[model samples]
Each structure stands twice: as structure tokens, then as C-alpha cells.
Target: MFTLDDLVRLVRDELALPLPVNGAVPDFDHALNWRSVDLVRLVLAVEKHTGHRVPIAELYRRRNLRGVHDLYTATATAAGSADPGSGTRRTAAGSPAAAAGPLPGEGYEDLSLHGWFARSAARHPDALALRVAGQDLSYRALEQAVEHLAGRIAERPGGRPGRLGLLCSRTVSTYAGYLAGLRLGAAVVPLNPEFPPERNTATARAAAVDLLLCTAEDAELAERIGRETGIPHLVLPDTPGPGESADGESADAGRAPGSAPGPDDLAYIIFTSGSTGAPKGVPIKNRHVSAWLSHTVPYFEAGPGSRFSQTCDLSWDLSIWVLFVAWASGAALVVPEKAELLTPVAHINEDAITHWFSVPSSLSMARLLGELTPGALPTLRWSLFGGEPLTVDNARAWQEAAPGGVLSNVYGPTEVTCTCTTYPLPADPADWPDARLGSLPIGPVYPALEWVVIDERGRRSQEGELLVRGPQRFDGYLDPAHNTGRFARWSEDDWAPFEPGEELTDAHWYRTGDRVHTEPDGTLVYLGRVDNQVKIHGFRAEPGDIEAALRRHESVEEAVVVPCVTADGTTELAGFHLGPETDREQLLAFLEKQLPPYLVPRHLVRLPAFPMNFNGKVDRRKLSEEAFDLIARYG
Candidate 1:
């Protein structure tokens, strides 16, 4: 086992610097280098020295090289031996760096996602970042706009990274409003501008938002939500011209740029669908996003010449990832017209989009409709698939469409910044096992991120439950009781014991609740969710397989398979579908041809639209419960 001094020596060698004889490390208080890419290299070096994973959370917790070395040594020491008295945390020898107190990158301390745009403005003040509705904002112009609005917000009583709800559709004003909020050191709580007042009010109240910003189009909803939640609201014009600003104040007043948010500062609280329960907010920080951009932008080689498209909703966590990658990497973000965007393949070809980040379903639809013609998207360089499983068929189709382009499968919960794992499309996805699907190549935990797959028996393997540990990981749920039970830990200390939320086991892992299997080559294969998988007639069933098979039908648009219990308490397979021209018999035949009898749905319930929660995912529990009701009435 390497000693702390040995680890420090390795780090010095890796960074090509002289080692401190007394081992006095640099102070982390103010040592942020604007170059995020360099930090990733340091993380990799630390991992090499320790022969263990260094999670993103750990990286954010350890702000400087010195703290990284300390954590490495501590983790190494613990791995080298075992502490019988370590209790539930099981300190092998030394504890990993105690979660740095109130770091800027991860947990609840992160600034809203707009923090990246603000930081980018500082780097490239004059570059063009956004263009919409025949209007454009140069980076400098955008920066000035944000500053003027932030000045107005800062002037307001008790303004400092507090909750500021944003209600606007996908437009430049939406982006400007978000930036202005972040500029004033305030957290942005984005609401679906199209959502009804009732839904808007519930979200605002849940987040305890202090203020509301909206466009005239969403003025009514914003006003209603603000009134119900008792949060002050403001409306910005659709276009802020030469003398107008987001705030009612004049647009010409010069104001200093917003405060620089720390890496751990709370960036945004994005509400994501919870598989275990209700909709929960995932707080992301600046450094957490920085870490992701640091890794992904370089991995994809994105730059100013790159023309990227955002197909996901801005409210969706995936959309934020797409937006940040574009701005941070200096790529041009193209928000295609609503009509064109409805057709993913057409949008790519029409816009000459170089990079497209979309879910697997969209790609699958593009293939079935024959919209992925050769040379249609010749400029496409990288196509990323997220938000759902990428089956082998879909992966192969995507690869075929963009022959030379990189196809990446990204996976992560909204809680861990955006994505934690990414696997570029393989030359031969068909070679992968059918049970493994094309999905699991979830890849590695990003730089500074630590992940593991463990079974219920605590056995670790490529195939098991996925656990994540990184700076991008969420601090805790919004509710204190929820935080206490799920996010806190009880441990034995030398003195008195304390239930600190910062500590972790020798593993330093966060249970992702996702079941995955890794190939011998270390590529992750996504298995079905623990909750989604169920036994049917003593046969194991995976909904993803059935869904993938259902999607194979030419007439089927979108499909969700769920289990339902009859009034007699007998379990049955049910399918909630959103599609046109789908014949019940033909759908059943397709499933029967592709899936086993037990896995095939016995009941097919067609709907004009799937019941989607706030996060856009099919509300499976609600759908399944309603499935029984529909069967009882119609069947």
C-alpha cells in the first residue's frame, strides 16, 4: 500500500511539480483555474496513483491537489486493511476525505444551471451564444443584459441565490431570465410555462421559491402560482431592445457582473420523476456541471464550429446537459422550429446539425419512418442517446444513419448533475448478448466520479445494483425528514457519535437503484430496473425488452409495459400505448413473435397520450393503476 507521502510524490510527478518536503499543500480557498479540462487530468492521475476510483463528489469535496492526495491516501489505507470496529461505514484503516464542508460543486450548494453561461460569458464575452425569432445576443450583449437584470434583482430586499421561479416557454427570454437570476446569486426554479396554474403553484410552493419571472405569454400562470405561493413575480417583455430590460427598470444602466458562484454553489433545482416515490428536486452545482463539461466537451471535441441541437425540454435534466455542453464547449445551439423538431431526423438534416442529443425513442421513430437517409445529416459528428434505454436495434440503426459520427449512450439520474456514464457506439452491437441489450454500456463514472455494481448480498460485479459517488451527486432531498432518513448516516466516532450527511463507507458509493451488468471488457449492460422487473408465471420479465419489441412494430409510436393486479389480486401484464394506426392484433402478434408468452402483454389499452408526469416520463404507477380500471370497465 502506498503511504500518504508516496501518494503525494506520485501526484507531484503527475503534475510535474516539486513535492513539498513538509507536505504542506496549497490552500483550496481560492485556487480555481478557469481551465476545467486540466482538473480532469489531475483526477485521472490521482486515480492512477490510488488504483481506485475518485468520484466527482469527492473531487468537489477535495477542492485542491492536497485534499485529493489526502483522500487517496486515506482510501488506499482503508483498502489495504480492515477496521473491525468501523461500524456500518467500515473504515478499512483511514476514512476517505470527510465530505468537505459546504463545497461549491455538488449537493444543494450548486448555483442554478445558468452558472455555466455566466462563467462562459466571462471567458468569451463577445462570442454569439444564442439566436432566436430573428434576434441574436452576442455573449457580451447577453452578459450585459443579465447584469442589468441582476442589478434590479439584487436591489430587491433579501436577494442572494434565493429561489426564483421562471415561467416561460423555450425562447431567448427564457434563457435571459434564467441568467439574470443566477447573475444576482439566486437559484432558478424553472416551471413549464405551458403548465396550468394549479401545477405551477404546487411546484413553486414545494420549492419555496421567493420570486417569479415570466414572459407575457405565461403571465397568467406565473401570476397565479406566485400569488398562491406568496412569492413576488415580475414579467419581462418578449424582446428587450436597446432601452428595455428584464426588470421594469431601464435597460441602459451599467451594472457589475454577477458574483462568481463557487463550484459547490447551488446552480438549479431541477425537478425529476422519482421511481421510488413522488417528483423530487435534484440540485446541481457549478463545479458539478463544470466537471461534466470538462470531460464531455473534450471527449466529443466540440467547439465554435459545431452546430448542436437540443431536442429535450429545457425543464428536463437532459436538456440542461445539452445546453451546457454547447455553451461551455463553444458550440452553436440550434433550437429547431416546433414543427421540424417534432421530426428528429428531419430537424437534423434541415438544420445541418452536427451534434444531436435525443432519447432512444426519437431515434427509433426516425429509423422506422425512413427519415435517416444517407447524406441527410452528413455534417453530424456526434449523436448522444439518453433518458431511456438504447436497445441493440436502436443503437445499430443510429450508427448506420450517421456512419462516421460518434454515438454515445449516456446514463444518470437528474441528481448526479446530468450524466455519469457514457459509452461510444461500438462497431458491433449485435455481438452483445440479447439479455444485455445495446443499453448497458453505461461506461465509467465521469472524472472524479466513483461508481460500483453490487448485489443485495454485498457482492460486487459488473452485473448488479449501480452506486454513484461524485461531487455532482445531490446533497439530499428538499424535505428534511426525507433527507434525514435517506441521505443521512449514523457512524461511530472516537468521541461522541454524530449523524453527519457528509460521511461515506470505504466504497463511498450512492445507490443508483439501477441494476446493471458489465461485460468482461468493463462495458455496462443495463438490466431492467429493480422495481420494473417482475416475475410472471415464475418466469423473469423485463419491461424494456417487451417495450423494445413493441417499438419494433411499424405502427406503434411509443409504448410502456406495466404490471397490474386484478380485483382478485391476480397479476397480469398490461400495456399503455401512445401511437396512431396501431392494430391490437398486429401489436400482440409483434410482441408474440419477439417476446416470450409470459413477457407479452395480455391487455392492450390505447390512449391518445400517455399520462406523463412533470418530468416527461410515462407515469407508470398511475398508468398501471388506471390500466386496471380501464380493463374493469371496457374488458
Candidate 2:
């Protein structure tokens, strides 16, 4: 199906290694000395393109580059011909050039996201809008269900613009619930069914939710939250039976009451980890999100035929981009169960996904599980990775697997709406940007958002703490106490070059606590965090909060949590405890009930007493140094 040259090119390009100047077969054993990531990428590309998998121990088993070419020729001769659509060459040049310069300002069709979806639904009434659990809902069917759910929400006593909680998994009820709340001019807060009930309870308490929406599966959880918070609940499918909630046919042909919510109106509230030992609510407005979609939709080239991979949960801010942007483009969003993420190649092929967005960890896990192959997903056109850095090997592997698709690494914080910057990689694997400080470059800034990196000296520089301000930036944290020192300001003189350094006035610039670098060409490169806060599996996490939760236990007196890299190269929480004469099993079990699954520490270290730094404070850094021994001795 593919030439050995194709195989050798992928290895040399991805591994950044020199191939034999003269045409010859590469030594499989020597080439196998390549980096773990690049080697994985080579195998992925070869297997997908040729349907040939080399042994993990032997690699391609070729003595030289010429040997690989002969093997490739022999393989092709053996197969007689390549499968249709197996080639990774350019497919008649891509769909036109992406417009450069600033994004068009007049493309937005409505003030609220729900309104835009309404227009799309009306325009393509029969187009597929959603697919969940093998059930497909057309645009017309989805619109009718939204209207019926809106009427039900209208009957509730929830006040105007109040918060409405939607507690459900990937189902028609959740989508209908979101539309219904927006129709009622209420801010919707999605409560993940997988999160600890206590965590959701605190989120609901923080948001001051007036109503809760749930499917039959989550009825008991809704009741618990409602009973705990005194908020009324409405069960979806209000009765027993399947398809009762999806509304396969129109409940009412006519539209529900008309409503016009402003651009600045609150749209949704997503909860993120709080350094203060509780989840913090981030309220994003319709305008904030609409501004983001204005740029990403065209950048991704999504439209009526685009099929988005719905991998993020509603609680995660990534959903904002995937959920609304697809609808605005009149595209169908394919929702897969959480478990499907483990074997994504199957779903990507079966669903013919055109666009993909997810954390690089998902890709790494898939590769670790051997779920990827060469020429596997030719349907993908755009593949974007965020939440964490995408390693050189991971990017190349994905690029080779989805040979026709473009790969990108995007970056942003929930505090600054969904996403703020996009770093699209060059289509040619050889042209991909080299890492800056060990991370792929996070390309150009969003057209509407302004970025400034401020150093510890409180002056703008090429690298420092990244700060973003513009239409996409949220108003502020939901809680006022969490807002201290989380903002910066710029004066008129600072905008224009007046002095070498001018004092700026107090104003509003959301401080993105991340430390980054700005290249001369205006590209941004993420260096590392200036603080202990981290993103584990795309969820904002604070070790202080994890430590606090551990200390809540009766046996624990002191705790410090540090980030630990597992053998598989995934980030995990490592909890070092001073008290609690306990084993890792007992502590993890206790923390499981209080923290989310991702927050649970994978490694537990118990100490007789906490270590102290020279300043008389618990030295977390010092504790991390001895983390391995502590775990080995006490784990």
C-alpha cells in the first residue's frame, strides 16, 4: 500500500535524525534507538499506511535504507495494490487558503449562542445535529425538542437570568436542557455526573442555582443536590421509556415564546479547581464565547459537513469551543461515551470525523494501547491538541496517522474564555516548528485578544507571566475573594511607546498565571507555570486543594501534593503526608470520596513529620526531592 521511502521519511523527519546520504536501508536496531515518541510515531505511520506492524523488539528489521525500500516493494507486490484512499499525498491541494490578517467582524449572526443555533436549525432542518448512543437527531428534531423543554423551563419558578444546573451525561436531555435554560434567559451550569456529589454540591452552592435538570439515570443525584441546596429539580423524559426525552417528532411545530438576551448576558458557569480548597465558578457570557467562535470556526474550516469529535465533558471549558462552534457552522457533533476515548480510532473511522480536538494525553493513551495504525483516519481534516503540551513524537504520529489532516496545538485558560491562541503546525512534517523550551510553539494570538508577558520586574518583556485581555476575557472570577492579585492594568502611555518604561494605571487585564515567551514573529511559546497550579487531564488542579482534602481525614494532620509523572509518562498527583499511619490504598480510597478521580493521588508518601525549609515554612520543593524514597519506603 505504501513505499518503504514513505516509512523511512517518517522516521527521519520525526526523529530529527540524519538518513544515509546515499539511498540505503536504515539499520532497524540503530533506528530503534530513536526517542520513545518518535519510534512510536514511526510504527504508527508504517502500520496505518502499509497495514504492516513491526515487532516492538525488532522494529522494521531492516539492515539499511535500501533494505527498507526492497521490503516496501515486496510488501506492495505481495498486496498487489494499495487500498483506496490509502495514500497520504496531497489531495488536489487543500480547500482554498485560510484568510489571513484580522478575523472578519461581521460574520456573527446572533448575540447569543442559542440564537445562532436556531438559525442553523431553521436553515438545515433535516441535517444531522447530534448523534448519541447510536441515536441520530436531525436539526428539525433537535429544534422541536428544545422548544418543548423551553416550555417546561418556562413553567418553572426559576427567576430571570438565574442559574440552571444541568446534571446529565452525553444525552439528548443535556442538550435540550442547555437550550431550554438559554431560552429562559438563564445562565446554565453543567454538573458532571462523574464528579463527587459533594463537589457538585459546592459548585451549585457557589453558583446559587435555582433549578436543576437531570435525566432518569441521574435522578437520585439531582435529588441529593436539590435536597441539599433546596433547589427544585425537573426530571427529563418526565416518565419511563426510551426516546421520550429525545423528542423524535415535534412536540409543537410552532416556536416557543421569543426572547432576546444581550451579548453581555451570562451564558454558562464552568467550575474549575480553586487554590482555596473548593471549586471556583467561572461565569462566561455569550459575547465572550461568540468572539472566540468568530475566529476558530474559519480557522478549523468547519461547516455543514464537518463532523466534530465530542470528547470533552460539558463541565470542561473545551466543550464551549466544540459544542457551540460546530452548531454555528451547521455541523453535526458526534458524541462518544467516555470509554470510547480509550479506543478512539474505531469511532473516528466509523463516524468519519472531519475535525478532532482533545488533550494530547488522549492520543498518548491510545498509542500506548495500540489503537492507532497508518492510514487509519483519512477522514480527519483538522486535529487540534490542547490542555497540555504535545510532544514532538505525538504530533508526528498523529500527523502521519491522519495523513491528510493538519495538526495544531492550542493554548488558553478558562479565565480567558475557552481558548485564546492557536499554534497550527506546518502540513509538511519536515517543516514543523522546533520546540521552544521543550514545548511546541503555540502560534499566533487570537485576533480580538491582546497578550502581554510581564516579568517579575512588573515590566513587559519577551518572556514572563502571560497576561491576556480583550473581548474573550471573562468579567472576573465568580467569587470576589479569588480575584486578588489575579489582574494587571495598562495605561494609554503603555500602549504607545512614550518612555522606556511608564507606570501603568489600575484597570482590568486578566493575569493568566502561566509563564510563556513571545517570539519576535508574534508567536507565543509556553515555558512553564510560575505557580504550583497545574492542568491534570485538562482539569485545573491545585495541590493545596488536594492537600487540604487529605488533611480533612481524621488520621491526616499535614499534607503536601506534588505532580508525579507515571511510568506511562502521564501526569499524576503524588500526595506526601506527614501524619496518617496508613497505606496508599486506604488514603486513596478516602480521598476518592472527596476528590474527583483525576485529583486522587496515584502515589502516596507517609512521613513521621513534615520537613521545613530555611524560612520556617513547609518546604514543598524539598519534600518533592525525597518523594520517591518516601513512596518506596512507606507506599
Candidate 3:
């Protein structure tokens, strides 16, 4: 057990916090102004020194040195005689085949996107289905709202729209509107209210949207987009009362239920950033998402009592996972307020979240706020990070906070379903692999999928661009023209580029553009984007490599490297880090030793935080432009 003096020294050295003099057992909350991160560090330090694990939650509740020591002693004493099997059981990788058994919609042939929720409602009518913005809806109540909204949409001027656009945020109407679209057998297109009207109008027009749905808060904006795009818009009520219909009439009056969609029919269309400055549409079918759910529902162990966090926006594909996976497993979909996202510890505890999914950038944000303390999120059982590379530091921090939870790094592009590969770290951190570039391995592709890595010379290799083709892969882009050079066919151990006017087949592999290397264990490690590689002073350099080197410094929390072009038409690398102020000369000296001189960044800038994109990933494009401007203006 640790003594009071050990706690005082650990607090001062590890956390940089002042404590009461003479070891009077000062109240950590009042005297030291200790945050969750500080308490977690002290507890971890004590455990390391004593070689015994204490109840971190109990120590946190104590909030003082004397209480923490006493609790630690009691825990140590009890643990001395405790059964080995009674400790936290190690989590194992869930079998995809096991997860396929007994879902809510089992044996339901030709199930559409909305069919999952309908089955869940029938199976668990009273179960909590949706919780958002201080409101809760049971599965039964939400299904009724979806039915009423579908009736309202079907009766619109368009008369059962074949395509529907949802213009809303994380509101009850947004979730209801999405379901309503699926209920009407219309392809749902999510439109962001935060985006420019012109962009939303273009998206609505491109998708050939027949109707637009929005909550009262976004009525004007929706109307503007509808007018510009020549589409009709309907405003959904803020909350659908238990008994009221869309227009306060009989809930079943003039109700025209749409026919169920076939497996091949488009379920939804998501627009991603394009190289030509216009968004590219990727339309996913019901079968594609069904394939994903078949693997994830059981892998995450979601069920009636589990509460999944909805961290992604409707426009992001991860939102699809949160919505359908929860409904499919009879779990509750919980959405936190925008502000609450930055402080995840409090949100997870207050909401009693069991399954959590978000971009790794969310972890970085919490780390910036000093909120990712050990055992802070004791209620979380499954935590998944995606949308960006998961750094070892971020993963360890999150794992420490949710010690009882299974932490996974999932990887995929929107072209695939939400994700296609996941790397679940061992329950014991000591057994985790020493991954390359300090990024967690992306693990193997799903057993249902087929993938290959092709080198620059067009030969199959262990390290190269990854290509995949499987049941979950999207057929092609909405615009066939965007399909050029996006796929390839392998014949006789060689690859051929997909040509225009040729039919796309399941045998064709979608070019993922991601560079990866297969480890000896058969797991794949992401090595940054092939297109993102930069040539610095006649030497090739990957920004991820440089960023990893920068993060090696004990003072650096996060790092981003971008190539900046000066006015002289010369390119140089600019390094940005989020951490305490350090002497630029000294930091560069350290990087010089770790990396080649040419790979070292020419300019280093310290930031309070990295700017995140709409999808919560680092905004590399914006940072590149900013770096160029800064370099051009200053040098």
C-alpha cells in the first residue's frame, strides 16, 4: 500500500499540482483543485509502485490522500485472499458466426433498413429506443411516430417520394425523419443544416430528392434549399405526442404504407468530399448494411439493456451504425448534447452508456480538456474509435478510463460500410503489440470480405495499397463517371484497371487508396494515405511518420505535419503539436535524431488544439492551406 508521502510526491511530480504542507491530508477537491485526470494519475502511480490494483472508482470517491490510502489498504487486504477467477475476466474477440445467431429480425426475408426497428419494437415494445436532447422514446412510441411521419410524407405533393432529404441535427425529428423515409421505401439523404444553403441545395438536386424533411428549428433553411432545388419540404413536429398524428388527425387516416424495399434497392446515399471540388455520392443498398450488422451486433454485445452513444452526425456513415445497430440489438440510442461531447467522462457516467463509438479525435479533445482519467467511465463496456488513425497514447488513455470495457480500433471508408476491419486490443495492455508508427494495427479484414495489397509495380505484396471486394462493399458511385480508376479486376495474378462502359462485378476490387503493411501476425497496419505522401528536398516522406516522431517527445500530446509551399515554389514540411510550450530549437534537435534531416519539418508551430472537420477528423486540407499562408507570409 502507498503512504501519504508517496501520494504527495506523486501528486506534485506527476500532476504538477500543489498540496497542503506538512502532509495534513488536504482535501484533493478544495486544496489541490484536482481534476479527474490528476486523481487517475495518482492512483495509477500507486498501483505501479505497490504492484497491486486498487478499486479506482472507490479511490476517486474518497478525494483525499488519507481516504485513498485507507481504501487502497482495504482493497489490497481483500485482494490478497480473493479468488483468481473473481477478478475482471479477460475479454476475447467475438466470433462473427456467433454474432449471426438470433437477432431481432431473424429469418425475416427481404428486410429493409427500417425492418430492423420494426422487428425490435415487436420484440421489445417497452424497451428504451431513443434518447436525445433531454427526451426519451420507447420503441413502441418511436415506431408510431415513424408511421405517422411516413403518412405525412406519403401524402405530400410528391405522393410517396422515391427519395427523401433530411435537413436536421441531433434531434428527435431527425431520427424520426430518417425512419420515416425508410418506412416510405425512399432513399434517405441526410442534409446538414450547418452547411451552406447552396451546398445543401446542390446535394438535394444531385440526389434527385423529391421531398425534404426538417424540424421546426430548421424550417427556413430547409425551405430555402427546397426552393432553390425545386423540391418540396415538410416540417416535422418538435416532439410527436404519444397519441397525435402528423397533422393532429387520426394516426391511421389516409395512411399509405410503402412497399418493402428489395435487397438491391438503394437504402441511403452519402456524399463525400471529392477531388473535383464537388461532393461525390456513394449510394448504399440495404444488403450492404445488413452484411455489416451481421458482424457488429454480436461483436459489440449490444442488447436490450445496452445504451449506445450517437456521436456521429446524420450525414456521417458512423451514425448509420449507431442507429441501426442499436435498434437491431434492441438497445437504446443515446445522443449527448454538443457541449457534453468534449467532456466524455461526465457524459458516459450521467447517461449510463454501455457501448461507445466515435472518431479518435473525440479522445484527443477529451485529453486536451484533461477528462480522460483512469476508471472515469466505469459504465462503458464497449468503446470503438474510428474515422481517423488511433494513436497508441489515445488508445491507452481511453482504455485506462474504461478498464472494464473492450477497446477496438475500427477502420473503413464510407465506400465500405461503416467499418470493415477492427483491432481489439488484449485485455492486458502489456500484451498489446508494438505497432509501427505508434498507430494501432487495423487487424484483419472481415472473414466475409476478400482483400489484397498491390505494390507500386502492380505485384501482390505485403506492403502496398489495399484493395477490397465483398458483400459489404458499395457497388459504385452514384455518378458512373466517378467510377473511373476507382476499381480494378484481378486476372491470373495480375491487376487490370476498370474501364468505362464495362459492367462492375463482385469480382472487381474497389481501390481503397490506403497504404498498409501486413504484420507477421497477419494483421494490417495503416501506413497513411498513398496520395498523401510528399517529396521533401528530393526525399519521400510520409506525414504520419513525421507526426509519429514528433509525438515521441514526452511533452507532445498530438502532432500534425503538412507540406507547405513557399512563394519561391519550394515545398517544406510544417509541424504542429498540441502540448506545453517547448523551445523550437530543442524539439527540432530531438526530431533530427529520430528522423532524417530532410524529413524534419522546416517550421514548427504549437497549437492549443487541432481543428476538426465536420466528421470529427483532423482537417488536413484546411491545415495545408493555413500552413501555406503562414509560410508564404512569414518566409
Candidate 4:
């Protein structure tokens, strides 16, 4: 019933654009012909007509208006809902409803993270919930901390449901502070204290944050940032003792400042490496988080007595899984020191940890250190690897060491909640999923996700751009400009006439930027990303962001950052510069003042001039290839 003219009028009305008296209208490739606002107007117009709103994030997904039309048509014909096409993903065979064992079937009055924690803590008040560096905090104790911190936060001049920066260490206060922000329904933006003050302050400014919650270690840093940015802060003790009272001076010293954001409200903002010379913050809503939790909680099969490893930085997205998944499963979360991660077998065996999740790089490090010899970790039962590609070799080696454990390759970007795909390795080595691409297959998408691959020519292909859509998908970027070109439509153009990847009837999907292939059984194979974004020791690093920081130095004239793989199979950012005279250590220290430790290039190569391509652009490929050799010579 929707006609082309009807779409045109809607677009004109929504965008407040003048309609041509000559009756000119946008064609199918309107995005190609229109400016940014025009495309936005068109999207709004389409949504108005369809009686639904598609996220601007669809621009980063499959960006076909035709596909949007079909999706709305199909969805509209069915039972209509407020968020049209929001619940379009297909549920997997053994979904939550069918889950058995210690994992209960889906039935929860409060699905919010705050709600879940409150209920869980009340039910088993004395259960060991969290431990950091051998210090234990039972559920009841953590709840009291949450209560004390939330009340303190609420009393601040600027109060709830906005961005609250958390500067904390791996301590009880860190866990308690994170929970307290959630209790007030605020979006918690974690600022790693080790990150250069410049980086933290810049990110805080970009998010327009007003207040911060910091632990004792980061108090001075928080104070400096507050003075520098006019954002007040509260200082929580390094540890919230189990029986601390309201009169406890340490608990009340949080003299500075702090939501109840809703179920669908933003829970947190995580910034990833960006190509545009700054980090891009992905605001994940509570529902986006719940969608992931509801699906994965049962899959892990963890119970109250189970122990979960907290080896990663809380800033890492996997830390999201470690925080909620462990507590939600009624398991004790064991936070690790940096050294604990290097020798994980000891951490696992010593603590009797039952559930472990980390990047394969850390596992490789464990093997390199001779800490992961065969049968080294018999207590581990489930090992989940993510953030970077998990090599088949690493998986097999880890499997051999923890013979009683199962290895699963979890794949996703921070943009799509935490993870969207999980591939559990077969018990038999030969029966394991394909790793011909130098990594274990990403396996099947999460039951709640639907994905497709778009080739370079804009057609469907067995290998190309991996895009996904589901309830777990994020709404859009904090900066809408990042949303553009992240999506394409499902259609055949003159360049390619065949269907690409898996065919979706009609829906907008999120382009993962990572290249992949889909197998006959719907399993996905990880190829590589189509951009410069790379994983550095489990953290997503963008060369542009690092390069931008390098340029910020007074002596630096120009800078280029390239991701280089070390001999050990881990990736590191390598910066090449053509700037004023500066030694590597000096430059590194300079960088240490403006970037996160991970973002700081492992190697800095100064060049008299950059190698140029025919197009007059820097030949980044050349720099990447010579990074190691250059580092050796320079060092």
C-alpha cells in the first residue's frame, strides 16, 4: 500500500525539505545522492509511515531502504509492537525456555542488572560474591556497600541517570562502586586510572560527564581531573570492609559527587579504538545487556559454588561478562592482579576457579611461560576465549592442559552488547570446527542474533563484511557521524547480481567491520576486519587514536600508527613518526601521559620521511611490514 510518492511526501515532511514543484523524488540509491540529513530524513519518514522507528545505527548495518521497507511490511503484517522489528532475531533450538539443570528457565520479575543483583544478594545474603586479591565480600556485604555508596552518591549536588565516571582498581570498592552507580540507574563510564590523565579527561569531556566515583588509589588523579574539567568526584576507600558502618570515616570521605536510568536505559559507555583520530564511545543500554545475559546465563552451567576468573581489566568488555555472568550464576568472582594473569594455571588451580574467560593471547602467554603444560589445570571446566581471534593451536594446547575443561571461542565487538557468537570446541580434536583461516571459527551466532556477510562489491558472499542484528544490538553511536557507511542494503547492483552471505527477509543489521564467512549449518568463519582496527592484547586499538595522541606532543610533526604482530602472535600498536628530534623513551613517556597503556605503541620508529603510495598517501602496508625490523634497528 506504500507508494513511492507517499515515501517522498513523508521525507519532505519529516526533513522539512522543499518538495520540487516538478515532482522530483529520490531514487533507490538516495543515500548516494543525498546528504547526511537527507538520509536521516528519509529514515525518519520511512519510520513514520511504518509506524515504527529504526535506529540510526542501521546506517552501520544493512542500509537498504528497500530492506527496511520489507522488514516493516513483514513485521507490521504480524502483531505490531512499539519497537517495530526490534525483536526480529530468530531464537536458537535449545533456547532459554528449554534450558535445564541448575540454570532455571526464564522467569524473573526484575530483569535489570540492578534488579537482578538486588534480588540475588537478598536471596543468598551470605554467599561469597566477589574477591579481589584474596579479600572476600559476601553478597550481603556487597549489598550494604551498594546501599552506602548509592546513598552517598544520591546526596551529591548533581545526581542520577547520566554518565558517571568510575576510576577504580581491582578492589571491593571498585565492584561496590560499579554496583552503586547501577542502583541509582546511571550509565557508568569506567576510566582506567592507569590511562593517561589526558586520555581520561578527554573521554570524560566528550561524554559531558559531571561527576566521578573513584577509589583511594585514584583519588589524586580524580581530584586533578575534577579541577581540570570542573567535574566533582567522590572518593571511595580502596576496600569497603564487610562490616563498615555509616559512621566509618573512610566510607563517608566520598565528600564529592554522583541515577536510576530504566530497564532500557543506558547502563554504561565503552570507548573503542577509532579510525577518526579519537576513541568512539558505544553506549550500551540495560536491555541490550539483559538480552545477552538472559541468553548466556544458562549456557555456562555455572552454580553458586562455581568460581569465575576476573583476570582482565574491568575496562575490557569481557569484564562485563565476568561481572554479571559470575554474580548472576551465584558464583564467586576472583579478581586477579596483573601477575596473576601471566601465570593463570596457578591462579586457576590455586583458587579452584571453575569458569575462566580470557583472550587467547593470555593463554598463549601462559604457554610461553611454561605455565600451561599438559594437565596443569584440572580444576577448570569451561574456558571462554575472546577479544582476539583464538588460534586452533592455542585452543588445542589449552584443552590439553585443562583436559576436563571445554574451550569456546566467543566472538563479537563491543558494539553488539558483549558477544554475539560462541563456538564451543568439540571434545575430539578432529571434530573441532574449522580453523583453516588461522583461527577457530566464530561458530554459530547467538540464538538471539541474525547475521550476513557482504562482499567488497556490495553483494552477498561466503566471505565479506559480517553484519548482525538482534535485541542485543546497541542502539547507535554516541556520535551519529560514526554511524555512516557502517551499513549497506541487501540488494544486487550492477557490480554484483548474486545474493551475499545469509539472506535476511527484511531487517537492518549492524556491520561488524570484521570480515567473515558463513557455513552451510549457519556457523560463521572469522576472516579479518576490513579496517585498521586491531586487537592489542585483548583491547581494541585504533591507530588513528594513537596517531592523534602522538601528534598532540609538542615535538611531533606527523604520526602514523600501524598494528604489528609480535613474534609471539600478539598484536601491538607500532607508531612511525616524522617529527622533531625525540628519543623513543621520551616519546613513550610523553605518550604515557596522554594514552592508555595498551594504546601506547610498543615500538616507536622515527622516520626522516614516510614511504608514499602512488596516490600520495602514506603506504601503511610498508610501515607495518618493517615495524619489527625498524624497532630492532632503532632500539
Against the reference, the lDDT scores of all candidates come to: 0.63, 0.70, 0.78, 0.69
Per-structure clash totals for the candidates: 35, 13, 0, 15
Q: Which 10-residue span in candidate 1 carries the lowest summed lDDT?
A: 94-103
lDDT of 4 by residue, 127-241 (tens): 7888885688888887777877777677667555377898887777888889888787778888878678998898888777767888777889998888889988887776664
Ranking by TM-score: 3, 1, 2, 4
lDDT of 3 by residue, 1-635 (tens): 36777777776676555675556655544433454445555655666677554444555556667776776677667667665212311222221111122354444344678887887898899989999978999998888878877777787665888888999867787888798888878899998887778888889998999888888888899888866877878877777643565566655522647587778888999998543245889999989988887887877787788888888778888988888989987889998776456456767777788888998877876675456877777777889998787888888999998898789988998898889998999988889988557588988999889988888766888888999999899999988988888899875467788889989988899998899889876799887888888998888989988988898887887888988888798998998887778888999899999998899999988864565677777778778879855444432
Best lDDT among the predictions, by candidate number: 3
TM-score of each: 0.71, 0.67, 0.82, 0.66
Q: How well does candidate 2 match the true structure in TM-score terms?
A: 0.67
Q: How many clashing pairs in candidate 4? A: 15
Number of backbone clashes in candidate 3? 0
Candidate 1 ranges beyond 4 A from true positions: 1-119, 122-126, 157-161, 247-249, 256-258, 274-276, 427-440, 484-508, 535-542, 545-559, 575-616, 628-635
After superposition, which runs of candidate 2 have C-alpha atoms over 4 Å from their true positions?
Answer: 1-106, 158-161, 238-255, 274-278, 491-507, 533-626, 629-635
Please tell me which predicted candidate would have the highest TM-score against the true structure: 3
